[model samples]
Target: MPMKKKPTNICCFLPDEIVENILHRLPTKTLLKYKIVCKRWKSLISSTSFKRLHENKSLENPVLILFSRQEGKPFLTTVDLSGAVLDRWDLASIGLQNSAFLPSPFGSDNLLCLVVDMQRFFVCNPSTRRACQICLPKASMHCPSGISKASFGYVPDRNQYVIVAKFKGRRNWRMITLSRDDVVVSAGNIDERWKIIKDSARYRVADGSPWGVFADGILYWTGDADDRRCLTCFDLWEEKFFVVLLPDEIVMIQEYQDDDQWLVELNGDLHLMYKKEGQQDIELWKLDGAGDWGWSKQDMCVAGFRARFGAHFRPVMMDEKGEMLVYNGGFMEWYKLKHEVFRMGGKGYKNIHCHAEDVILDFKLHIDTLL
Candidate 1:
């Protein structure tokens, strides 16, 4: 007969770092289950240190979290790859009370941005949980149409940040480039005032491909022209637009081309994942140089996958050791050596709060805007 082994209490024997290493691999849903497995897990996993571990892992495998922008009462819902729920927060309470509006966050390092209203924006660090709100007449003056998207990009030429808000209505709306120098500044003025650079102007997005990613000192947008969808690459340094051809296989779906959906920079290359016609999977295109974008296809999804899923899987910059972290399929998933993938789960954070409109855990990561 097999020896009846006494119940081993290994958790107490292990170091906290070891425990966190194990905990970091669990899916958010599984983490929820593990939290109830025992008191040790419940206490150990809830500490700020454990959260810091997860946060560090997140900066490694940062998951792009999208929340439902409810009108008047705005809130964000997030989902992982395994279709797990994390948490959702009410934006209204945080002074982002425009429910009818869209809140898009661009993330890099510790700084996450939140685009509030049409022109206004905010940047926050999830690890420290500190946020800075943007105050400006330009942001407050412009109100975008119901269907539009906005982005925040850095201009190398000016050594400043720019907020680009794109609005789409009956016609191809306009582009409001909020430059720090554009707003009128008072000479030696102490009160908040800005010096405008370029007056806000409107132009039709070429073929309706809409805005792309801002990468390598460029703000990229997409437009479909002449029955073909192309990437409208804008040079922030020179203020010019360059068009690049998209793969013929990919249909270049319209809905996912919004400001935050497409364009992911992975391993120093831009990845464009889009839906293809009559096919279930999405296309993965890579832009390595200034020339044409290389394309490939990856099924890489179960049911309910989409171009919007790209937003949830944006690549988080690697840590000093060069590892990327992300939440895949509703679980904790991280990248190793630019290709290997791992799942990191947490306790109780899974299924924390979720619904149809709201998916995984609600963790918001925003990008920086013009100040």
Candidate 2:
């Protein structure tokens, strides 16, 4: 009598631990490929274990992920800073959306973006990994006033965070706040169901640009004043508007050229990156604790920047101590320690490009590996 052949079961063949180990490293795209391998793999891939594992491994070092590469179309591949991947699957896969996008994680939370090209925004709970999309009312869409800048923030004081979309629509510069408590209706909620908090100052919406930042319960942005655009700040908690005067350095820098502004946190203080020259001569203007952005050449304490300034360049903030990381011409380069702008590390993204195919290349400090 011949022994019955053992059933060709893949799940029973490999160690459960080994399969999961391999699954953790494979990206979301590759996971889709393995779904057909066996029923067990399909189950494991969709299990909460996978999501929890990714979240745990993600907290160590921030990843530099490349997002939105078109097939053969050379779109600027965004280094997706948000922890979880955002693709066609997230909205539809989770069953909470229809061609709607969510805000990509902003600043440090590993969640940014509220969605693109659509008048929708997502409110998410990072700790629970749960999210919901909100639609505004249609009447609010035609914004008799135009949308100037939108900022979302959480205030523990009120036990509710708000999605504050600043609008300079036809009427006034109003602050539109939405919260879960504002979910008056269930399934069919309109996107414009927002209540307008009118302010005394009517901010202008120039060409419908959505550029704004939220810090310490306040929203800051660049606004037009007397035909000249300057910095503007709004307090969500206080429900008032104020202006932050540009530093002499920042003001002078803008006077001579385009008012290029970028925001980042340095040593916990919010900093405004104003570049009047190239990356090599990029000056650091102190936005807080020191003074306004107007730094004097005599105050910089650095030398040789006046003569060799190139204003056309990009800037990146890094946590890699003494290692300022930047991707130049699609290649990753690091600036040397102590020096401001000389390319140091040779580990360039020579082969990386924003191609249509799905691939992920990211970096993190090795220190967290021990965690």
Best by TM-score: 2
lDDT of 1 by residue, 157-177 (tens): 554555444443323322333
What lDDT does the true structure give each of the candidates? Answer: 0.48, 0.46
Report, for all candidates in order, the number of backbone clashes: 58, 38
Model 1, C-alpha of 346: deviation from truth (Å): 12
By summed lDDT, the worst window of 10 consecutive residues in model 1 runs over 182-191
Candidate 1: segments with Cα more than 4 A from true spot:
1-90, 99-110, 126-147, 155-159, 167-203, 206-212, 251-262, 291-329, 332-371
Q: After superposition, how far is residue 78 of candidate 2 from its true place, in Å?
A: 7.1
Candidate 2 structure quality by residue, lDDT tens digits, 25-66: 644445667778888888887677675574456454334434
